[model samples]
Target: MLYKKKYSSWLHRINPALKLVLLMGGIIAVLFIHNVNVMIPLVAALAGMLLIGSGQPIGRVLLFMLPFLFVFVSTGSSMILFGKGETLWWQWGPAVISRESFYRGVHIGLRALSFGLIGLLFALTTRPVLLFYSLMQQFRLPPRYAYGFMASLRLLPLILEEFKTLQKAYKVRGVDSVKGWKGWWQKLRLYAIPLLAQSIRRAQRIAVAMEARRFNKSIQRTYYYRPGFSSEDGLMVICWVGIFAGAWIVGVQWPLFEITDVRFNE
Candidate 1:
C-alpha cells in the first residue's frame, strides 16, 4: 500500500532493467555460496541497504517482510527435520535430526531469506510501469506485449475498486455476510460473475483504444518514459559488490560455524 510514483532515493535513479539484471546476477552468486558466515552478514548488509539506499521508511520494508517468516521457516525446517547425517540426535519413522542437518537447515533458511530480500529490494524501489517501459525501450521488447502488460497492471486497481463498490451495493440491498467455506464460495460466485463481465467489457475497450493508437510490434513508436542508464547505476553496482565482497572476506577470516560446505560428507 506504500505505493509512490516518485522518490528522491539514489536507487530510484538507477534504471529498472539494470536493477533487475543486477538482482538476478546477485541471486546466482548467492546460490554458489555454501558458507553460513558469509550469508549471515550479507543478509544484514542487504537490510542495511534497504535502510540507506531505498530512502523509504525501514519500518515499512520490515512490515512488508513479516509474512516471509513462514516462507523461510518452511524452507529451512524441511532440511532440519528430515536430512541424513552421521551423528544422529533424534530419530523417528521418517524424520531424522543430526548435526549436519542442523547446519544445512540454517544454510537453507538464510538462502531463502536472501532470495526473498533480493525480490523485495527490486519491488520496493522499482515502479512496474517504468520496468515495462524499460523493457520496451532498452530491451527491444515488442510493443504489443509490453503495452498489454501495462494495461493489465492498470486494471488491477480498477478491479479492486469495483469489488468494493459491489460489496457496498450488496450491503445496501440487505445481503448478509457469510461465515463458513460454503458461504464463502457462494459469495465468491456472487461477485465473480459481475466482475468477469466488467473485466471483459474493459478489456474490449482497451483493445479498441490500443488499435486506435497503433500499438504494432513492427511500428516505431515514442515512449513518454525513457529509463536510461546513468552514474547512479554504477554506484549501485559498486555498493552491492562491496557488500558481497566484504561479507565473504569476513566469513573466510572469522567463521562462526565450523561447517563451511553444507553439502560435503565426511
Candidate 2:
C-alpha cells in the first residue's frame, strides 16, 4: 500500500514477464540453497528490488517479512526437537535429536521465509490487470479463464476488508462470553457463516456480470492493453538464468552448510 505510484517503482518499470521469471528462478534457488549464507545474497537482491523497483518503503518490506521470519524460526526449532539422524545433538529420554536435523530444519524454515518474501515482492510490484494480460499473451490462456481470474482479484481486497470488520465486531460483542471450547466454537461459527454467505453472494454476482458481458459467448476478444516484447524482456530471462546458476554453483560446489555425522547408539 505504501508503494510509489505504480510506474515509479523499479520493479514496476521492468517487464512483468521478467519479474515473473525472476521470481520463479528465485524459488528454485531457495529450494536448493541449504545455507542461509548462500541465500542471503539472493534475498538481498529481491529486497533491493522491492525497495528500489517497487518504490516501496523499507519499513513496508520489513513489516511484510516479519510474520514469515517468526514462522520460520518457530517451525525450524520444533522440527529439531522431533527429528532423528546420525548426528544426534540432544535427547530427552525417549526422543533423539541430531545436529544434522537442526541444520536441515534451519534450511527448510529459511527457504519458506524466503519464498514468502519473494511472493510479497511479486504481488506488491505487479498489477492484477497487467499480470492477466501477460498470462494471456505468454501462456495462451483462455480469455474466459483470464477474465475469471481478474474477477476474483477484484474481490480479494474487499473480502479481506469484510473479514477484518467481522473480526472487530466479534471483539466488540465479546467473543469470550461463552468461554473455553464453547466460546471458540461460537467464534468459528460467527465468522464462518457470514463469510461463506458473503462469498456465495459475491460469486453469484460475478457469474451474472460475466453472462451480461457475454464473456463465454466467444473464445476470442480484443485487447485494450497490449504488451510488447523487447530487449527488456530478454534481460529478464537472463536475470532468471543468473539466479539459478548462482545458487547451483554455491550450493553444490562450496557446501556452505556442513553436516556432522552423529549416529545415536548406546
Candidate 3:
C-alpha cells in the first residue's frame, strides 16, 4: 500500500479529494504570496500536518525533508545571487546582492519547503487507489482515464521487480562486465528494450481482457469502493482555508517582507 494503513489519524481518514484540493490550494497561495515571513509559518503548519497525518517520528520526517531542503536552499541561493534589485548590499565582478533580492530568495526557499511538506502530507496519508476512486466518484473523472493512471502507478513496483530479476539473471550468466557511466547507459538500453517489450505485451493482454469484459461498452460503471466526504473532510477544509487566510493577513501586516516590484520601478 502506498499509504501507511496502520495510522488512524484524522488526516488519514479525510477524503482524498479534499486532500488534493488542499495541496493544490496551498501551492497556488504560495505562488501568489511571495513573502518569507508568511511562507515560513505556512511551511511550519504543513510540517505539523504531515507529522500528525503520517504519525511518523520527527527524525524520520526531517530525514525525508533533507533532499527537499537541499533543493530549496540551492535554488534560493541562486535567486539571491542573480536576481536584480536596487540598493545593492554588495557587488563583486558578476555577483551582486541586494535587500529585495535576498528577501525574494528567502521567499522562494520557504515556498519550496511549504510545497514539499504539503505534497508529502498527501502522498504519505492517501492511498493511490483511494485517490483514483475519489477522483472518479467525487470529481466525475472518467473511469477509463482514472483506471489507466492508477494502473501505471501500480505497475511501478512490478517494473522494478522485473529489472531486479533481469539483473540477477545476468549475474547468474556471468555477463556482469558493465561499469561507469557509458556502461550504465549501455545497461539501461539493454534493460529498456526488454522492459518496453514486456510492458507492451502486458498492456495488450490487459486491453484484451478489458475488452472481453466490455469495459468500454458503457460510459457509466459501478465501483467496488466508493469514497465519501465526511465531517472530518469539512473540518479539514475549513482549517486549511483559515490557515491560508491567516498567513496572507500576517504577510500583509509584515512590511519588511512585502514584495517589491523593483524591476518595473527601476
> Each candidate: RMSD to true structure?
2.6, 4.4, 2.5
Q: Which candidate gets the maximum lDDT versus the true structure?
A: 1
List, residue by residue over 4-118, the lDDT tens digit for candidate 1: 7665588887899889889999999999999888999998888788767777777877887787777889888989988868888988889898888988898899888888888
lDDT of each: 0.85, 0.69, 0.77
- Give model 2's TM-score versus the native structure: 0.75
lDDT of 3 by residue, 37-108 (tens): 767667767777677667766677677888888978987898788887786998878888888788778777
Cα displacement (Å) at residue 220, model 2: 3.5
Task: Give the CA lDDT, 0 to 100, for residue 46 in model 3.
Answer: 71
lDDT ranking, best first = 1, 3, 2
In candidate 3, clashing pairs total: 0
In terms of TM-score, how similar is model 3 to the real structure?
0.88
Least well predicted 10-residue stretch by lDDT in candidate 1: 1-10
Q: Which one wins by TM-score: 1 or 3?
A: 3
The C-alpha TM-scores of every prediction are 0.87, 0.75, 0.88
TM-score head-to-head 2 vs 3, winner: 3
